[model samples]
Target: MEISTCTEKMVQIIANSTLEKSLKKTLKEVGVSGYTLFDVRGDGDSGDQSGHLEGDSNILMMVVVPLKTSQNLMEALNGYLKKGHHLMVFSVDAEVLTPSKFG
Candidate 1:
């Protein structure tokens, strides 16, 4: 199989459930279309984020987007982080199996 040069990335977002709305809005504004969300459980610098309960939970979101869109989302995320929202974002290469689906 040949690897395509799509410049796409799998953006992973882990944050408190409270930040879900803001995260969704930013992703939409940054041109991200599809994503997979999971109620996750983990501990971090802030504290235990076991998404076992409604209020005390965490959200894990993964989205595939072009590099430009990822950059934009990263920029917009700074403000939320500054406000002390538990957030983390990472971008990695995305292998394209169906290019048309992304366009």
Candidate 2:
């Protein structure tokens, strides 16, 4: 058996469910090929996110991309923060298989 791994950046964003549509659009605009999304619940400085209500829930979006693309993604997400939206965004080093799929 043979395997290969490539260096990539994993971008994770946690935001309100109401922004799902806009967020998905932003991802495509930033050249992200795909992403994983989950309806998540947690407690943080913003308090408890129970994810039990329609528009009051939270979502976790995770995408892997090239380092440069990751920077672009963060810059785009920053626009939301500037507009007073509550979003938690960050990126980390990642090793991924079939890296071509993530660009």
Q: lDDT for each of the candidates?
A: 0.79, 0.92
What tens-digit string does per-residue lDDT give for candidate 1 at 1-103? 8666554778899888887887888888877887899888877787787666676898889988777777887888877888877688888988766562446
RMSD of each: 2.3, 1.5
Clashes of each: 0, 0
Task: Report lDDT (Cα) of residue 49, candidate 2.
Answer: 90
What is the lDDT for 25 in model 2? 99
- What TM-score number comes out for model 2? 0.92
lDDT of 2: 0.92
The per-residue C-alpha lDDT of model 1 at residue 40 equals 86
Q: Can you give the lDDT of residue 36 in candidate 1?
A: 90
Model 2 spans > 4 angstroms off: none
